[model samples]
Target: MLMIRPSFDTLYEALLTRDPSYEGRAFVCVSSTGIFCRLTCPARKPKPENCTFHETVAECMAAGFRPCKRCRPTMPEASADPVVKPLVEALEKRPGHRWGEPDLVRMGLDPSTVRRAFKRHFGMTFLEMARQRRLQEGFSALADGGKVIDAQITAGFESPSAFREAFAKILGQAPGAFSSKPLLFADWVATPLGPMIAVTDRTQLHLLEFLDRKAFPAEFRKLQTYARGEIGFGRTDVSDQIQAELDRFFSGTGASFETKIALHGTAFTRDVWRELIGIPAGEIRSYSEIARSLGRPQAVRAVARANGANQIALVIPCHRVIGADGSLTGYGGGLWRKQRLIELEQGYRAKG
Candidate 1:
């Protein structure tokens, strides 16, 4: 069943009365307090002008409102489901543990049922989420300047070689390959959708990609060759600047990126990226449309390739590009993330 969002008056009345009928169906984002709450929240209500209603926690977050502590509006709606609650709690408690069907079976739960429950509530199976967490742990360890053995143990890898293989497969280089003394630095920045790896020098942001992107390894190698500097796990003032900008972006407070970025691409590709940056938030353009805007109407294919060639993610706004037929084309960060980003920017458009 499609759950439509309640009208503003309907939601305000519910909030004033602490109505339970709209418990999970509606949420309130308060501009004055910078927080979101459930209609049933026991805390004091804000003035009507300060309140904006949304249908989901994601929408509230996209508007830059943090969850209300008094009501815990960020809690999953399915947390009370018998099959989901315990498993979620277990995952939280054992984040680094490798979870599998056998583990669910040992817990006297049907693995298939568990998978379905998690996918319905979280948009991913429990095992997939668990693996992502494990990868985060390993990445965090390395970001902290820990050794390969330290990261392996922290990530729950069975052996050094196992950890290195997995790291190389994802990052395109083994942890050991990074130099202790280096000219360029890399760091991890956590985002609402996932973790992103940020590469920067002292002055300009060099690259930023979601850690899971399949092309990241090759992208990293290419950047290393171009910079003629060893890359290491460290942060620069530029990294700090981009992290702050990203925090504001996901919080829905602001979308403008002021971080200086080093654009490493051919002249044509650079022109395409500059055009992409011209795309306004909450708007989309087709590859052919981008080409035409650049006064190269016959270069539609080239526009698409240049879009794909963009190494910087949100800063470049490459996700704003679509197929000529208005279909979402491939994004290196995965189409799912691309969709979420587009949705998130709609909040920006609304506010503007």
Candidate 2:
């Protein structure tokens, strides 16, 4: 297999900043220390002259660098985090347990320390992570057409209202609001970055957004209304197809998303998205550049609005748009994810 890696300077910059977004995507080997560490490693930084970057731990080992004890770049990420490992293991053991700060106290862990550690590793506080997991359980049950009470029990929510509120917060509707027989289906698709909700009809995908995105609820509500409350929890043939394509993309074997997608935007917004789709995997463009391509050089702000209004993620390639100064700007999935996505696509460019 070809080794997919970002640019040398990019990896070096990640090493310098200890950027956690590059955690599994890249590793650094320090010649002076004879060891390799994760980009988020806490060890003292070495001079650039002594640094070598690799795409995988095996490559670092092949280059004669042992894994650093501090970061344990060779181990799975959760194992390297003192606070994340046990808590994650506990979560797996009891998927239905509602976690709180008091639970951290019972485990002899400081709540503040636990919060910071989980956020650093998982991009969410431990309580939030726990809540997401519980919701996943409930969502899965509901997707199978189980009763609301069954989902609440599966999610370990003692109060029915609490489960309903949580579900509403995520999907913009309570369990009863969803149609039992519906024209659209929504299901979770796990990716290397995070879990994304894919809403599709029988053939075309309508919406695809990261679950943790701040804009997801509003976007989903808009989608829900557009579908006339006919969205249900389930998967379609299109869902299976996208999942396989996503697997290949993350595995570096393929980067194509061939599933037919439905566009629900104004004519200009649709045109902007079509232009974004034309951008090569390894390349990036700015809003002004996109506007110029569309023969509306003055529509830079409108181009930006179209970019932000993108409902489908990687498929539409909104992350490919950057500031004219080459800075990453606001991304609905978070800037960290945008940076990591750009880095990942650079590998695809290298392969081609």
Candidate 3:
């Protein structure tokens, strides 16, 4: 799965509007201009048909696109300017500091000015920027076997209630929802497609899905129940392995996954997923074909249902399953991604 990309038209529109959300996540390679630029690049916007979007700068370079001088696509992404640098450095140096406007004032910065500047540049307030940074750091600490007290302190939250409230405010879930010693942990994996949310234990990857799915919240709750509520914020050995394999897969250099996966679905669903994986990279299988292969020719609908129920996206290879008529069918991550994956696989296969 890549960044949660929209249709080409939508991306073109975002490029026209200079949507900052896509700054580094998506790149537009302009054939006419002979260069690729950030979506927010100030150069004269190119025509829509001349635009080709790639998930990473590496792709743009591979396709012979030089970075735009206006947007500086290859540069580090810290709100696109040096203004946020000092504030960010301050937060990192003192993650446990109680950040407030008065503190900014004492630091010789105007409160309203800083807030407006950050809001315009990063789509977040100055304090919000700090909170988010601290939250990620705190989650990292908690994932590394640190105590909750230590996690909060490391996150710069002076009180447990403050930390819990901040966590709940960002995640929209209770911070106390996990077991004392979690058997499962959830962390993020950055991909060319976007970011994938991964649920894993110390040994096996359980669930992996795109972050923007409409059914993600419910899917996470269901995973929590399947893991007997032993979910927390953290990274595991399996997640590290999964990310590495996925990186290779997306780079088109490897088509196999060596990491173990824990399937929490029904027996039929697991069977369907295993069959999906066996279909091979750069190939497609119809639902009926899969049902027949499973020795249950009448279970075509069941096969499709199981395909839909697959939580692990690229690893399970649900996108490999297509309509009986050879049309793209429903994909939890969207059909555009399915089409992209098929094209990618077919292209690699053709080259091989």
Off by over 4 Å in 1: 1-94, 104-110, 113-124
Considering summed lDDT, which 10 consecutive residues are worst modelled in model 1?
57-66
The full ranking of all candidates by TM-score, starting with the best, is 1, 2, 3
lDDT of 3 at 152: 84
The sequence of per-residue lDDT tens digits that candidate 3 reaches over residues 180-207 is: 6788888766555655678888888888
Q: Scored by Cα lDDT, where does model 3 land?
A: 0.74
Quality of model 1 by C-alpha lDDT: 0.80
Best by TM-score: 1
Task: Indicate the TM-score of model 1.
Answer: 0.72
- For each candidate, the alpha-carbon lDDT, in order, equals 0.80, 0.80, 0.74
TM per candidate: 0.72, 0.71, 0.61
Which residue pairs collide, candidate 2?
A: none
Q: What is the C-alpha RMSD of each candidate to the true structure, in Å?
A: 6.3, 10.8, 10.8
